[model samples]
Target chain A: MDANWIAIAASVLLQSSPLIIAVCGETLSERAGVVNLSLDGSLLLSALAGFVAAYFSSSLLLGFLAAAGVGALMALIVAFGSLALRQSQVAVGFVLTLLGDSLSAFLGQNFTRLPGPWVQRLPIPLLKDIPVLGPIFFNQDLVVYFSLVLVAVTTWWIFHTRPGLELRSAGERPEAAFARGVAVRRLRYWYAVLGGALVGIAGAAYSLDVKIGWAEGHTRGLGWIALAIVIFGGWSPLRGALGVLLFVATRSVISVVLQRSLGESSVVILNALPWLLMLGVLVVVGGRFSEQVLSRLPAALQRPFRGLLRAAPPAALGAELKEG
Target chain B: MSRPAWLPRLWPLLPSFVALLLTSLLLLAFGASPPLAFGAIWEGAFGNQDRLLTTVAFWIPLMLSSLGLLISFRAGLWNIGIEGQFILGAIGASWVALSLQLPAPLQISLQMLAAMAAGALWAGLAGVLKRWGVHEIFGGLALNNLAIILTNYLIAGPWQPPEGGSFRGTAPFHADALLPLVGATRFSVVALGLALLAFGLVVLALRNSAWGLRLKALGRNPRSALLLGVSSRRETLLAMAFCGALAGLGGAVRVLSWFDSLRQSISGGIGYLALMVVILAAFRLLWTPLVAFFFAAVLSGSVVLQLRTQLHSSLGNILTGVLVLLVLLFGNLDSLRAWWAEWRAGRRRS
Candidate 1:
């Protein structure tokens, strides 16, 4: 029984690694006041690029680099289009998402469902000997460890670092940040690119590590889920990581527990669970009801509750930035 | 001053020309001939009578959904859940067609009405969720999945054929329940008439109606619109429902004419394609149908493009996507002029 539980826990962590990376990447972008709404498209295109590159060059590093490049290029388009051309970010992102999807579909015709390279598991030296926690967290591949470190680093960078403070200010009050000589446009441009590069890596992680192999829409709707979870996590990196874990855990439980007892028919209905969870999380954390409820609590409890439930977005997010 | 009379007129078509150039470059990168692909699409879409009719068949649902989107977009709503609403419409029409014992005309009319109501109700659910502080994008997305699951359940569970359940779909509906198609084609004059009627109504409503003015105000600034005494909640629900109803009608047309029974992927991403159509049209009423027809033609032609060139059918989608992006980037004359001026200034500085 214990072994089964540990296995399930480890699988959940492994499954959620890509999402964790993607969510952190998105959190970084949203923190810098840019919303990369083209995540779904970016992810699909990058997954294809990653798989294709890895297949041809036979190197995982090249696959990840190519995917990140594609991701950064897409982010640059969104940033430039919205900031320079004065187009709506959502419009640009949405168009890019569709463009990316079709582009992948057209370009990836020959690469569909073909077996390709993947990340090999590399357990830590002494940590694998430990009991439950070791097998669950430490006995995973490089991508999994990277995701863990990414969450901690992202949380620290966004909350503790001086540059992080500037990023927050860029997202929360670009005009004020600019007044303080923060170079908001340049900061936004670079951070958006950085975030997009991380997103690209996450896409590669899926094809070269998590899900494995390339197909059209290999990561469809995941970008939207990541986008929704960014809001659900209140744009916090740590919280977003937890959200992905919780989502992946519940999905595994449903597929494993329910699918066994209910048979094949239940699988179709079960597919709706993740989306339903997304809606449920957004409604619970996103609404004014949570704040109202928090306010009604005792003084001692209110602070913790407020911190836990806070879900407001960055003030300057998606706003057009004009350079004079 | 010495330029030809048509030269100024040609400026408006600049985005299309640019998009064509970009698509040509993409084709070249793929080691495919642009002329051959374009020729394939053109021949596939309009080379023969049958192909023209097929393109028109695809156009009916696309036009309906695009028209519906114009309403919601005017009200500043994304209505991404239109996909779910479209599926609900198919479900509603399927319900009527399967269970009803009415006359042919009555059955068809009832099916359409049911489809509209189902679509409106589904869209209204998203609107209500929006009212509850859930953005329609998330709500609609979730609802779309739920709608798909619901369709799958219906087809595999309760509505399964006499032989047994399968993922293919439910059994075909009775002849009386189906739409009267034009000779040897899925194209129905009735569906065409409905779409054209919707187009006329949308144009008139957006142009002359007080409601259209209210939607414009709301879309521009919701808070200010409320301050100006516009009831945003009422307008939002009404606009979403109105859009859903049309999309549902489009769904009804799909199941009733395009196919014989309720099936998987009934809308086939038409809801999303319609969104692209509206955006490409620049949200203008006059251009909506024309752009939709263009999209429909490309998509219809893709089948032939694939068959002849051994290329994937998504080339049409890529072409449209590129066009829309270019339009978003450089379609506006002001943006183009600004970019041109900036380039010249940068060169002089260097």
Candidate 2:
């Protein structure tokens, strides 16, 4: 029973790697005040591009690079359309979402269902010998390790670094950031692209690691889930990673527990769990009413509850930057 | 002295040409002849009376959804959950069709009313969530998925046909429950009339109503509108419910006319397509139906484009998506001019 539990935990962690990467990427972009609403479409296109590149080049690195390029190009369009042309970010992103989906379907016709190169598992020799923790953390492929490291590195860079401060300021108060000579628009452009590149990596991760294969919608609704996690995590990388884990764990538990008890057909309705959870989390943690309820909690419980429940978007998020 | 009178009016349309050019380049990359492919699409959409009627059948639902979107967009709401509203509307209609045995006209009327109410309630849930601090986008997205799941549940569970459970859909409605069609084609004069009436109502409501002014005020500046005694919450809910009602009615029309049963993917991204229609029309009342018709034609034609060229039907989606994006980018002549002048000034500086 214990071994089975360890196996489940390891599988959940493995399942969560791509989502963690995506949530981190979206969190980074949102931190810089741009919502990459094209994620769902971008993921599909990048997954296709990534698989096709890896298939042709026989290199996982090239595949990731290709996917990242696709992601960055899409983000560049969003940034340019919004920043340069003064278009609505939401409008441009939404259009790109549809465009990316169709573009992938149209272009990926030949590549559908084709097998391609995937990342190989590389268990750390000594670390893999350890007890329960080792199997869950160290006995995984490079993609999984990269996701784990990325969460830590992103959290540190966003919270502890000077450039991160500028990025935050660009999202939070661009006028003030501009007053302080932060180069707000430039920071937003770069961060949006960088975040998009990470999202691209997340896309490649799905095709090359987790759900390996090229298909019409290789990563379809997962991108939207990742976007939701960014909000659930309150735009923090560590919290976002935790949110992904929690989400994946719940989904795993549901599939295992509900599949046997309720039979096969009932499993379909259980697909709604994550969406319902998304709505519940938004309602429970996002409102001022939640904050008020938290304030009434016992003193020791209040602190942890506050940290878990604080949900505020960047102040200037999705607002068009105005230059004086 | 500088530009012709038509230039100002016509220049904004440059993006659509650019979009076509870009799509043609994409087709060329695929080693397909652009002219042949476009010709196939034209022939497929207008080849015969049957094809034209088929396109019109598809147009009713698209037109209805687009009209609904006009109200929501006017109030500055995204209504991304319109898909879910459409689904709920379908479920509502299906429930009436499956459970009741009424006269032809009564059955259809009940179905339409139930669909609108279901759609409005689903949209109102999103609006309520927004009031509770959730953005409509996220809430709508969650609701959309839930709506899909609900449809799946109904199809595979209680509403499952007596034979066995399958994801295909519930059983077909009785004859009285179905809309009166034009011979064998799915096109119905009743549905078309309703869609036209909806368009007229939307145009009138947007142009001349006092509520329209309030929506404009709210959309322009929420704080100022509130200060001016315009209730943002009430208006937001009303606009969403109104959009949902129309979208629901469209859903009913879809199941009754275009389809005889409540099937999986009932909305089939029609809600999203309607969004594109509204955006491409630049949210102008006069252009909504025309753009929608154009879209309906392209999509209908895509079936033939795929068969003739051996390309994916999503080619239609690609064309429209690119067009919408380009329009958003360079559609406004003033913005495009400003961007051009800025580029020139920067070049001179360099």
Candidate 3:
């Protein structure tokens, strides 16, 4: 209820949004059985690309759009490896991370410390005026709001819509989906690209907000956290966003606490706090739930959905569109 | 399709080498001669006794850490968090070396024991999680991050030096506890050599021992291994423990040798590079040292690359990336076969 707490809470919400967006985007990727561990690299590339594009064009949309383009391109390479070449999904994911990190660093070399076009916050007047919960809920950058909408939309699509059903089917049982006339491979490609775009948007959110600065390892391990969040969410969008909220909020809390308690000597050591917690979550919950869920979860998460390999997807997912 | 008797194996390596070569082409764009740069890489690695000693010094920890990696991977487990394990090991050893004022030999032995124990504990936690249900990838990665943070906390807080200035690291290591560096090299020789000899034992154990066969069985097929009364989880814990111990040895060497001064980034990307080394060597322990030395050369020489060219340190990483990807892609010559078949068909049509 305090004024200062309100501001901090609002910032926390804003910070969490990018994580949610990245996690949701990665959800689509992993749900389709293609774990793009390259989220860190892709997010970094897009973050750099977004900042650079926004910086040059002085257009926020252009920057975010360019970020999406970069993400999709990176995703395409992963797709080329997994879908076309039938490589190990994890290996491809790993390769993409290495490639993506370097490429982002190389291309973003010019944009270091460049002033980026700040994404403006779109606060509803009445809502922004309210105290406490008002600013936290109502006032925010466009991407923060977009991320919330994306969560709802993604959940709805995956659970309610026909296309969503198809994608789910492809992810759960590609062969079954294939038998039912769904173009599983093509579906995977689009899902990965779209998912990548979302990740890119998340990266853009970082440049637009969240310390709109650039450097090597700029995005740090947000991408990997996104992957972990997806699993923590149990392949669900709403849960994924919550996980991100938890992740980013804990991160913000760590920063504040470290600032208050930890002396100068503690800074370097304290920097590892939030990440340690994230890993702790995985070791504790992520560890136990993995066996239980993996036993019942999609059998084809890592293995390619080879039509010849006879891997069956969930019923009704990716039913053939029957195009001429 | 074969060009020579040994072509299959030799051919498999060609793609990765080419990939590394092409990545160097990127250095040329930065105004460095690719061949000349490679020459520097060679010199930095093994051009002479001095260079070789330095490279070996660098090679010791890397070899120790990567052999640990190979131990896990050979059993079909991936412990990318060896970096974290390595950090924990260093801390463990540092705790013994710095905190306890025991006799020289006893201090060293206790430090080694504690270091290995700490690594085992950290990695074993991951193994427990993996067995409990989390996959190795997620569990190991999370453990890696946690270990790093914890290490940072320890080194920055209790172990922090009094006159901490620019660089944030632990206090100076006691000279007695420092791993004996052989020759005029900056790298740790005795520590690494001892570690390498242990690696030989591990290699022998993995290839010829019953435990090794069981692990291979687990890697090749979990159900079958389980059917044979081999507990995959137990094997995973044992292998992970071994891996952690090896990484811990590296960490101790790091503390005693090059980084007698503490560092947050001591393990650096060595854990990740060890992953790549495991990939390059295809899970062979002996090959780990060779491949890791090659990478260490690139890492050490990359400073020179920065001196000579406009390229970033990322070039070395990118080269390693391309190599890892290429090796995995071309493993068993699948791509080359597809390419060769296409070429032959085109030739017949012509």
Candidate 4:
């Protein structure tokens, strides 16, 4: 492959790291029957908090921790509001998102364009020397590497462990899970907060690693993209990570094509491409077209095809659970 | 155990009071005097006739958008893409204003119609997706971003002024295409009057019409409404399209009367603010305009807050968010009370 192609592949991985983390986080939350719709605002506020903490302390670790803390707090509010107050999760999340956006813009004004600490690249020794896969996967910053590990770890945790079964039961049939000795509400709160913290780490990754600066609306619109990916991923961690990669790849390709074929004016069109593509993906995935195609397959192939094409959301998702 | 009528009347206002108190504390934390900031906000919003007129100008679009959202909310749909619809409306109106050479009134009316069509078409896309099982919220959000990008492309690309590309927006519309301002203020009385007319029409339709009842029924329980012979597909499309038209009309009024050009942030987050207004009004058509006006005042006041205190104007957004959240939490006080009572009774039995 050409060096340019190799570089593009690496860049795609780098760009997708934060999104991958965020997608996993949202997938985990949604799988546990909670929807943290405050992803966008949470990202902005955490991005700001991460940048400021890193700048003041000169420690990237502290920045990531601060970002995660902020993320968890926002998630905790959504969980508390929905679980305890019996408020609509969507409403509470939406309000927090707007509030977080404005608060971040207001608070981060001073930190805009300021130099801050960033994550350093930590390439694995043996893996970095491999010909094709090495540069794309193993050679990156700590966050990028961690994001890959997160995909595998999250996939394993969600599908392989005993707690994973409990989580699924909590989301799919909360009353049944409660009868089976599960604390559905408490489990929801834990996963939502945990998922939110991961999302916060994604934000910090944007500031302290990927984009690497503090700016107003710095992480703008990314949270929404993450939310869409969670859906596209069918609320599964591995699939969600793949969805992020696909989105990032599309974005990269669009930018490259725009640079090659069009002037700066057409950049607007390029900017619209990701959203349009996501819309198309959503329509295809959620629409009847897929179902029609699935039915046309042989009966032997039909079940697997349906499984791959249709990933239904958890049955008890978004519903309030009452104690017996 | 009957509640006093006066207490019920005052109950809805509690959330606003709590939000304001909390926001005041936020101001204090920022080292600004809450009283001084609020005083400035009040003065800036309605202290003078000129400011009051400006507030009205802002209120028109907000009211229109809120009314649009009210329609969709009543139909069990969340039209989060109202911002996109609003932008498309501006684009549609701007196209008409720029391309058409008609008499002023005829041109303005045509522009509004074009805008409404554009908005309906945009929102209809989301409706179609929703009909196909795509969630309206996600579809709307994607469409919203696409619409913004489309608007930005138009303003900075083909619609770029003859002087070349600039983000300042297209050249001001022809003088004839512009709405006549009320006195020296930017406020257009005709636009305000039309908005009120729209509001009145919505109120009438929602209250007395069979269509309104069907929509309310659809929202209350889709399965039951469907069993009752309300066509979900048709009603969903109609509700979304009508809401889009209302939001489109808002965009038309905004472009023609105030800004007089297309810009990227022309919607000015009014779509989201309108959502908050609808929530605050509890979907009551009667209170939408009042809530919208209150929000507009806060927005206008925030501009003054920025000028005087060097505080960011987004403080108003923060205030709005706080207010809506508080209302969402406290709005269910009656239900919470009942739940608590039931819990205590159960505990007593145990």
Candidate 1 ranges beyond 4 A from true positions? A289-303, B1-12, B339-350
lDDT of 1 by residue, A217-297 (tens): 889889999999899889999999999999999988878878568865777757878888988888778766576777788
The segments of candidate 2 whose C-alpha lies over 4 angstroms from its true place after superposition are A262-265, A295-304, B1-5, B165-167, B344-350
**Candidate 3 runs further than 4 Å off:** A102-110, A125-134, A253-272, A283-324, B1-7, B101-104, B162-167, B335-350
Q: What is the TM-score of each candidate against the true structure?
A: 0.96, 0.97, 0.87, 0.96
Ranking by lDDT: 1, 2, 4, 3
Best prediction by lDDT: 1
Enumerate the candidates' DockQ scores in order.
0.72, 0.76, 0.37, 0.68
Off by over 4 Å in 4: A296-301, B1-9, B338-350
lDDT of 1 by residue, B214-241 (tens): 9999999999999999999999999999
Chain A TM-score, cand. 1: 0.96
Better of 1 and 3 by DockQ: 1
Please say which candidate is ahead in DockQ: 2 or 4.
2
In angstroms, give how far residue B283 of model 3 lies from its true place. 2.3
Instruction: Report the lDDT of model 3 for residue B334.
Output: 62
Poorest stretch of ten by lDDT in candidate 1 chain A: A260-269
Worst 10 residues of 2 chain A by lDDT: A261-270
Q: In candidate 2, what are the lDDT values of residues B1-350, reduced to their tens digit?
A: 37677776787579889999999999999999999988988888888888898899998988988898999999999999999998999999999999999999999999999999999999999999989888898899889888988898888888999888576999899999999988778899999999989988988898999999999898889999999999999999999999999999989999898888989888888888999999998898999999999999999898999898899889999999998999888888778787788778766976
Clashing residue pairs in candidate 4 are none
- Sorted on DockQ, best first, the list reads 2, 1, 4, 3
- Against the true structure, whose DockQ is highest? 2
Reference A-B contact fraction recovered by candidate 2: 0.88
